[model samples]
Target: MGAKDGRKGDPEGFGPIEDQFQAIFDDFFRRPVAGSGRDRRIPMLVSLEEAASGASKVIKATFEAHCTDCKGSGVLLGGPPVFACSVCGGKRHVLQERTLTVKVPAGIDDGQVLRLAGQGDEAPLGGGQRGDLMIEVIVAPHPRLRRAGVDLFVEVRIDAETARRGGRVNVPVLDGERRIVVPAGTVSGAEMRLAGFGAVRLGAEAVPIPAEVTAAPYRSRSVGDHRGDQIVTFVVGESSTDGQDDTSEGRRAARNQGLWRTGVLAVALVAAVIGAFVLGR
Candidate 1:
């Protein structure tokens, strides 16, 4: 009887039902499954030496996880639903803090991010898959050194006599101090290269040491067979004096010239006074 009414018998009449099924399938696939949390990004600060040599560091991070009290449903299931979950307050998740030990790769630059799989937030009532955690690295500035890509630059102050005579001088290195030869007639801002002293290149086979071993210096293989160079720039004079002529003779000459200028100024002031008195008379 329904076929006779042209409702069930027509193929076009089934279009609305097929469309409804298609819509249902699409919605089911598009919705995120429970327990799949969002990814998070956090910052990690490291020293220049630490960045050059890979090390494991412990860091604290906060993220969200499904509430264990309500099982992520946001309500109590044992009784008739009357109010939200007391633990999560209907949010389905709670903030959780955890300490994680992360490996910082050698030669890692500032603003670079390292991803840890499944370390992000836990899914809220979704599936068991957690999101990834991204750690953005921040390299601290060194007191006497500046970094450019894989190269490191340092300014070493040398006296005028040493700059002219050319001799060995102590310069700072990543581990400690080292002596480098300076050629005769070397001027200020002259740069000398120390090969294999700079940072390790990224993607090198660098192995990280344990956190406990960080206090004691350990070299990582991440430097591979070759490393970047450290460029030493020679600055003449004492750094504390702001690039002034620091030689003893130079200081004595400067004082004598200052005294001569003071005497001349005094003499000019006395002559002006005598001329004024004469004009008044």
Candidate 2:
């Protein structure tokens, strides 16, 4: 899929999920398959089915949904009549904010959830503890870099000068300062990769940007050895300095990506390549 330019507004990340786990009545066995790999402790995703006559599995899915408005007291913030809940006495909650930072363990895939205890609504009658709050994590898309598990994809633009002569370039990556080598005649939209620059893995390798080949429009796939190349798109420009300075943040980032220089190099490269072919033949 084509990536939307990152130079635009920074896409707002989906906020955290801070409520109860919505139950799926049927049985859910979050356990490993009978025989798959050496990892026995690894959990499996078993679908739940409603049982008929008899069954050995059962689940008690209980949770307290927080009060939507006055934040758990079921009262308007203005004054008296629309006032205090007689039970908790306007204190709002019978439980404290669940303070367990809740470890977001690695290997946990996207949309995975982490639960924190006592983070929901308290009993209206008082005395009992609160409900649990679940946080769901989702991976956000990167404008320039594409993520594949623990790997990252970064796209770099090379000008006719950098492509034909080859040089060092500063590229945008998950962890910045990724110095990349622009090969001679590198062409436009060519990608230079930094190995082990991907997301964090569990233990053995916390995070690694894998070395594999890349593809996609202004995108990177595995950085490797194959028919993969950095795709280049060309744009013709009217050469003149009569335009105002690109003061906006987005324009500046585009310029840093060498888009301005790329336009010039594209025209120049075509002329040079044609001249060489004709002269050589």
Candidate 3:
């Protein structure tokens, strides 16, 4: 018998018989009303150089109402048998744009997050917490500058002549160009210190390095001095010299010629002495 009939024994002949059961549950209890969900969002980012934003400037951020066409939903709405989801208004989450002034604290490391309080959208259901918006201050890498911890490192290539001769070398500093004295006999790879030549320190309130010369001594020793190291790889001349045998008569002749010239020089000296004696008499 059909579900409406009272007969109980395998009426449809599909499976084992069972006692009467309660399988029907109402679907209307789960449908949500309009404005039921808390706020949900996706954000956009804009990055501009610090100098680009002039003084006395303010940036405003705002959110738009959900689109009525697609109802803030991006998807194409409406089909015959199956209908589109109405909650996203056919557009997914409604937009809730917000704005906050991003403070770039000095000496903040790259990728560090700055939290904006109460700036994010509200939670969808139950009036839960608003989402947190994090802003990161990125100091773009300088093409010429290399940074360490509080220490900033810079490399300069000095010619061997200048190093050996010892003279003034120009080094770049944070604010301006500086002249540093490179000692005489300074070898390549020698690191000389120009004090106070580093990046901005975050908290400690003091000028970093005083104007003082830090000599990185070389491993080369000349009796007594502090020494580090400078690896100097020499390029040897591979072209060989032509062979000359000492026993060859040509060399003997050359030697004999030199002896003969010395003999002539001696004779001239003797004559000069004799002439001096005659003049004295």
Candidate 4:
């Protein structure tokens, strides 16, 4: 029998109810699929100070978007049955360049990911939605400082005399240079803490602490303005003054001369007193 000569009662063209049900069941049991467009990761390099203090950055990238002519439909506007779009060539998406100004929050650690919603490529077939753009932050290495969690570590080089006598050294911070006092007899790699002078965490405000108040041993803590500490590691350095006169050295020399004169005068007085006593005897 020919293929077209099938009997009406025994149909071979249409599938059985069981087969139809099986097909439906297989379709329903299929695994869920993710979105078509892929997410993009961009590396952003920022200075340590900038990471401490929140800053803004402008990002420029090329992404896929729905064609303006097709309006994401992949069809032309001319007829009842739509025609393929000439501009996008039925792809419905076009390559586009966009710029976004992203605000980088404070205390954003290295390798941290920042997500920008709907900033990635558009769906390929017929645009429905877009993916996200992820920004990975990278903190650049500093010459004299490093960060651990929220705390900042700075290596300060000071003269041996200054380290022994507890003098001040200029330390660099986010805002500016601060004169940090090195305790007397401080050794190499000794860390000194500067409260409220470290990196600012995210969502924390920068408060202006008064000098007198900071100097006070007992000060009340405020809310919503938490600041980390700066660790100043002292490195004993030598004075390299060949021709220029160091003020500290000059003062020390003058003080030594004065002490010598005083000692000589005291000895002469004692000798005179002994001579008088001997003559009286």
Candidate closest to the true structure, highest lDDT? 1
Candidates in order have lDDT scores of: 0.70, 0.37, 0.41, 0.64
Residues 1-281 of candidate 1 have per-residue lDDT tens digits of: 11113334555566433433343345345436544777889999999988876779999999978778878765556867344455665556678999999988888989999999999988876568888899999999998878998888999887776677655567777777665666668899988876667777776755332222221123444432545767888888743222323343445556788999999999999999999999999
Order of the predicted models by TM-score, top scorer first? 1, 4, 3, 2
TM-score of each: 0.65, 0.38, 0.42, 0.64
In model 3, the runs with Cα more than 4 Å from the true position are 1-93, 96-99, 122-129, 205-281
Judged by whole-model lDDT over C-alpha atoms, candidate 2 comes out at 0.37
How much is the lDDT of residue 179 in candidate 3? 51
Tens-digit lDDT string for candidate 2 (1-281): 01222324534642111001111111012212211111111112211110100113222232333333445443445656554433323333332332233344533445555464654444432444544455554444545655544445555544444445444445554434444444455554444434434444433323333343232222333322211222222211222111223342334545667977898899899999999999999
lDDT of 4 by residue, 39-152 (tens): 667888888877876789887888766567866555576755655566655445567788888888877878888998877776544344577899999999977678897778
* Residue-level error in angstroms, candidate 4, position 83: 13
lDDT of 3 at 132: 49
Q: What's the residue-level lDDT of 241 in candidate 1? A: 26
RMSD of 1: 15.1
